[model samples]
Target: MKKSIALFIILISVFSLAFNSCSSDDDESNDPQVATGSFEIYLDGVLFKQGTNAEVGLIKDNQGNYVNTVTIGMGSETGIVVSGFPATISDVTTMDNDSDPGVNINVDSDYYGTISGTMTRTSASKISFDGTCTKLMEAQVYTITGFVQSTAWEVID
Candidate 1:
């Protein structure tokens, strides 16, 4: 009986050790998560579509909503800065060297934003929003006025 008990405990410890070793706590980017959020679209300095761009914002906010803005470079004051580029930002680290805090910009410089949220193409060249942002039908829409694209929400997922 003592030998059986000892075997059982050893087996349990081995299982626990194996499970912990196999767990993926080492890599954050490679971690698989359900990507879901709102989206906005733009084309050639125009808001041709709001849901065209794949992946809008990173994740839901404190209020359980995804938000991001699509903007192009208008000058030194507008546009979105690519994640790696350094020249495309202001004093704020969140504010890329390109995208502005108050305006969506469309310039030649990397016309893209942070690739967050699950923006898999449910349809070719098309994207959809799911998860924490289902009721964002109205607030997450973008408006194209001539050469400018505008968003009302703080984030554009």
Candidate 2:
């Protein structure tokens, strides 16, 4: 009877160790993917901004819905940040970056205002962006366009 109890305890310990070792946080293949890429901005069909980096991510909201957030940071005092709540990969969502009807932007060392745009999730690992920003402070109206490639969510059968 003593031997049987000893054997049971050993088995339980081994199983616990095995399960703990199998758990991992380094694997993001099955998690929400984050993507970063480069983009260019054209000011009225002319090259105005270049070498800007764009980052995109999908996160869950308080309502358990996935939301899309995008930030484009151009060197200097220029940038465009937008977010769409409760968005999905198959839906096109509109973002008002400046808390109004436009996107958030900064220029000439100042936060100008917002721009209007559309965000599209092309695939599980890709997104497309299109927007028009009018920086009335700088007297410049430009179009912002770009795409980002995700980190590739993986699924284990």
Candidate 3:
């Protein structure tokens, strides 16, 4: 009878250990989360503002190098796209204007420009830009400043 009781207790203990080891709370997802944020940019005195329509994440460039990008109003005709950033940014990183342009401003999908200024990574999920864009064809220039705060960064292929 004692052996039977000991065997039953052992079985119960094993079952308890197995159940505890498979806890749902301890199972964390390894997938990259989608980013969410808002941004506003003033182009030639015209204001373009979007709420919850911004995404900041890491994407691979043409050379397969990881670069940081912030896209606002992605699906809309008028938006702002800033890319060519290093995989990791410092307090205030200047925008590069070499062969690989760093910033692209799309106004009504008509005007495109390159930015000359600095980008600040305030936090892990927040970034701010302060600079000016020079229109491609025209000699027009305007101030472009904005900030994006996202819950997380979405890693894009």
Candidate 4:
């Protein structure tokens, strides 16, 4: 009777361990990453600005293409604007600068450049992008690198 009781206790312990090992916590880490309405900009390999606010405007055309405009750090001196590019993305489309020349960048109303990299629509209301901007200011060339993950977007008529 003592040996049977010990064996029963051991089995229960094993079962408990097995149940706890397959928890939902492990599945949480496997979930897909989403945007959190934040962005970072680097100028010439140096940290320029970091912000937690973003605005995105999206418009869909008759042909089912999506046009998006994004603004980060709005109303601040260290702002960035992206327009005309990512012009044909859908809910899950990814586009690069090579295929889309319509992407323009304006920084602080002073630096102007064109974007070169990739922009992806992670969801219907979110986008993630990493790009380099070759800015020209007074005949001087500067490099600006940025990454944006916006949490929400508005559909425009």
Clashing pairs in 3: none
Q: Lowest-lDDT window of 10 residues in candidate 4?
A: 27-36
User: Which lDDT values do the candidates have, in the order given?
Assistant: 0.27, 0.45, 0.51, 0.44
Model 1 misplaced regions, further than 4 Å: 1-34, 40-47, 56-99, 103-157
| TM-score for each predicted model, relative to the true structure | 0.20, 0.46, 0.58, 0.46
Show where candidate 3 strays beyond 4 Å: 1-33, 44-46, 55-58, 61-66, 86-90, 98-101, 154-157
Cα lDDT tens digits, model 1, 1-157, are 3532353344334333323333345355432121222334443335433322222222234795533322222222222212211111121123221222222322332222221222222322122221111111122323322212223122332
Q: Which candidate has the top score in lDDT?
A: 3
Question: Model 3 over residues 74-150: C-alpha lDDT tens digits?
Answer: 44354455554433445566775431234555555354444477777666655677677665455676777776565
User: Which prediction has the highest TM-score against the true structure?
Assistant: 3
Candidate 3 global TM-score: 0.58
lDDT of 2 by residue, 3-93 (tens): 3235334433433332233234536544433333454555456765544234333334578554354344433344444444223566676
Quote the lDDT for 13 in model 3. Answer: 45
In model 4, where do residues sit more than 4 Å from their true spots? 1-36, 54-66, 84-109, 122-131, 154-157
Residue-level error in angstroms, candidate 2, position 146: 3.3
- Compute the lDDT of residue 48 as modeled in candidate 3: 53
Q: Supply candidate 4's per-residue lDDT for 154.
A: 36
RMSD (CA, angstroms), candidate 4: 22.9
Candidate 1 has what TM-score? 0.20
Which scores higher on lDDT, 2 or 4? 2
True lDDT of residue 18, candidate 3: 28
